[model samples]
Target chain A: MSGPAYTPTDEELAHLQKLSSEFEPEVTGPLVGERQSSSAITTEYANADPVYRVKTAALPSKYSHYRTCRGDGHCGWRAIAFTYFEALLRLGDRNRFLEEETRLRSMGNLLNSIGFQEHLYEDFADECFDLLRKTESLVSAGNDERAAAELLASFNDVGVSMAIITYFKLLTSAWIQTHPNDFAPFLDLGQDIRQYCSTQIEPSVCEIDHVGMSALAEVLVKQAGFALEVLYLDRSAGEEINTYRFDPVSNDGLPLHNPPTLRLLYRPGHYDILYKMEDVQQPAIPQAPLHVALADYADEFVPMPTSRGMSDVMSLIPGMYPTGLGQNWPSVSYDYNPSPIPQPQMAAVPTYTSVPVPTTSQEYVNTAHHNVPLESPVGMSLNPPMTIERGGPFRPSMYELEPGFQSNHSQSLPFQTSIFRNSHYNTAHFLNPDFQPEEWSPDSEYVTGSRSRHKSASQ
Target chain B: MSSSRSQTPTKRLLNELQTYQSDPNDALVELGPVSDNELTHWTAVMKGVPGTAYEGGRWKLDIRIPSNYPNAPPEVKFVTRICHPNVNFKTGEICLDLLKTSWSPAYTITTTLTSIQQLLTSAEPDSPLNVDIAQLFRLGDFVGAEALIRYYTESERWEGRQSV
Candidate 1:
């Protein structure tokens, strides 16, 4: 036996391993987490661990909030599955929920073709369907907050959560089987695609890899149209987390325009959801437009007359002259970000610079205020703030003549000047104004193709 | 979480029971829980194929599924002892890959039992649990192995009747 095996008596290493093993969590409960406020994540991890400190510190800039998921092996599937339901609930569209329910039930065909009987996955699929049905009733009753809360509750329940997770695993496994040729070249781990899926991907506690994530994304994104981005926070030599986008294309090969409805913070071993604080805040703040000028550079670069232009001009006039006229423009930055109607890319204007607006305590108000109409239609209430609240549409405004109002939040450059200078926008345009977004529609061309190509190349 | 955890296995077991009861495979197999209140422990009684060496044999398996039933595979063993190269004669432990690492949640109690039945017809001699029987079969001693298997089946059947 080549004498005795070589062994090292590393005392410090043994001590560290013992200490870490003590923290290795037991998988006793269901594979889900109670939805925590995004800020709570910062409070929970910002100080205790340096790695998490780096992750949490960088998280709040791009993602102003994050919900910590349970660190079970099923975190990847559970996080995405919970987000799928929550996204539907946030849309508050029952018909869409029903359509999703139908589509999920139909995935039984994928399972069946792979030789699983109906009863095996029927119970799990039924649990998901039942959750959808219950959520729909709650949403339709105008209890969106309750609907969201209850949905999270159900996720924590073991039976329902595992069922959904299992069904997800099965469908992903089936996808690998049904399209073996598509997956074959990439199964380079000295195992066939089926063995890899069964051994490494389908089990309840198996953490997913790039192929697993993409396979699940192929099934879900195509069926549900929910775009996903996973910011991988690893030991890589970067201040920012590496982002991976998973957006499956339609049959026509045209990429769906669904904005990344779900964002996940992926540490080496686990995944959790990230929230944009701007999207979650309620419109309740003293009208200071405190950082309006820095953000207003977006106004000077306005290129066209759109509804977004009118809203920006309307929102700006008050911020432009908060104390000049007797107009009380209660901090309208909430209106600055959450435009109910989809608008043109005013946020991406090349000349504009992005400045991080530090969030105030009052911004913690729940996202329920998202439904409040942007502006009163009749404009009878001449309160500048109230007028912006009722400003439903741009209604062919003569105000288009105003130059500073051309850009909207969509045009807001994704690169915000972080309080931490280390937090540079990884994109080339952070320093260059001549960056032609037209060469690549930064918003439309999702990172999916590039990521899949990378995965294929690695294979 | 514990209640829900138990509920999934129970619910799956009940669903399988109902499916088996409704569409009974009368000629081939009979399966049900050991007691009405117990879903995790089941009894599967299967008949030998008509023309195989195991013809006229009756076998009963003790199927004890874990609380994580479908996710984790069931523990199956022969309550009615029989001789086969791939099975331990004393413990009735199987040497089938499906009952081991190859298990998937898609495999139900019915599918598992059926695979065991197939294993009987076509035993994998190379990976044998009963090395003596495997050696006999390897040495073109089919008659010796068949006689022993038939005798073991009959003795097991009579022992079952006597217990009843």
Candidate 2:
């Protein structure tokens, strides 16, 4: 290498240096883009190297959806922060939002212990807290679509988004500082943790490195009982993207079962959110009302002559009606024995059926018409139909008589018998459209034993 | 969206002004908006750090805040000329990372001014805006650097006082 033929003078050199120093790569896009199909990623990589094509081709199958974060140096932090609130929204739990607010607020002590100025950091922290409250209200109101839209809108606001990112960055710094033993080994020889944090973690223009990501996962994601997963989509000679998961654990140190996970797709220097098919599943909450209403209608109106004929016709269609039809129908008909049943069960059924279907013709006209008002009393009458139906020739189990019995039974009954666990009738079985995994509970183990014995004796 | 874009910075600036008013830092001679109607453009007066070569000098700073203040850092520069490694003598532009990439929403006007005052006592010669002054400091010629700094500070101090 030799000097250029026309060597620049000092003044020219200074101007060139200033230009180079001021050079910023032109960045364009929303701060956080709308959720889009991950298949677009596959298409983007289709013309690239074979490795990228292979990896991205496999991406959509596992991670069905992805949202892009603007690659202006804060993508990783913004991705994690956006996903954290999004994971909370996915939970759709009101108290979880409050609990998270309190948990983050209490971390002020952590922030304070590390000498972070409270009054200064509080402005950023307030933005995060305000977002949580806003999302909490939306989730509480059962407006998840609006909640999600509002979340995307909030993050798109540069000031609000940067505030949250700054707050999270400070938290990550504080966490790393407090847990030096966990992170110090990753630093250069004898490098001060505080120096590394100020340089690499706290700077607004510094993208999150691996160490910062781990600290953020520990401080924010894991503490909230949500897992954090990073999928490396690089040319690492693999057909599938490599995945690294940080699972939240119970107090006993076991990874929590099926915890809601926050996932990020890391392609060298940038990060975007990834979603498993299960993650974007319309929360079972909205659908549960429709299911309950149909189940209730079937229970109440099945005893009526016309509706029984309709169900008989429905049963003729293979797989349209659930199995055990003969057993359930006989029991339901038995319950219709004009025996002057329990006043509570009679009142519950009539109240639901009467209010929703004002005219007799409307009741029999079409099932779809009842969907609107049927959703209102889902919270109230979910268990009553099962209770009334169980008040037949078969002895009602103590569990069935309890409030919230249907949900508990639906979740746990698959485990009561191996035959049921393997059968399509178990909602926990994968063949079911609304497949829910059978969650094992220590309290339910005893109930399972008693119910199994009672059921075996009845058989 | 536009209203909210301005509202957050204005609110934060007001809160910062109140905090600065209630508990002012000793190093800052005065800090506030240039005009009551405009919060984004302001002025600051800082006393040079004690026991430094630039001591006994009053430095006026031009502070131009972005619409998204706190999120985006305020631009602070010297209005009264002084000689230093990290400050441009003619342009008054500073080379501190705090006003650039390292800026955070946590920093307020008072805290930033305090940092600027601190920057006088701890000049980084390695990444300097004024190559001539930085060369003096880099060559371990502190006496020469101090003389040049004092000459500029004292001469500029008189000019600054007259202008005020």
Measured by TM-score, the strongest candidate is 2
C-alpha TM-score for every candidate: 0.61, 0.69
- After best superposition, candidate 2 residue A92: deviation in angstroms? 1.4
In candidate 2 the C-alpha lDDT for residue B103 amounts to: 78
Residue-by-residue lDDT tens digits, candidate 2, A248-285: 65444545544677999999999999886556766543
The reply for model 1, stretches above 4 Å from the true place, is: A1-25, A28-30, A37-56, A189-207, A248-252, A258-260, A278-459, B1-14, B21-28, B35-39, B47-58, B66-68, B82-90, B93-103, B118-164
TM-score of 1: 0.61
Indicate the residue-level lDDT of A282 in model 2.
65
DockQ (C-alpha based) per candidate is 0.31, 0.31
lDDT for each residue of candidate 1 in A1-459, tens digit (9 for 90 to 100): 445886546987878786896675775534555544555655667565566555555454346566766776778888988887876776667777777777777677888988768877787777778889999999889788888778888888766777888888888889889988878778775688878887766665577787888888777644565667788877676444577777534334444432225778887788888765433433244221111111112322222122323333332211121211122223332323234332343323222112223322222221223212343335322222222223222332423322233433224444546543223332334553433232344553455457668899999
> After superposition on all CA atoms, what RMSD does each candidate show versus the true structure?
17.6, 17.9
Model 2 agreement with the true structure over B1-164: per-residue lDDT tens digits? 51253245777788789888999899878889999999889898888777889888888899999876776789999988879899999889998888998876666788788888888989999999899999999999999999999998888873344467
- DockQ, candidate no. 2: 0.31
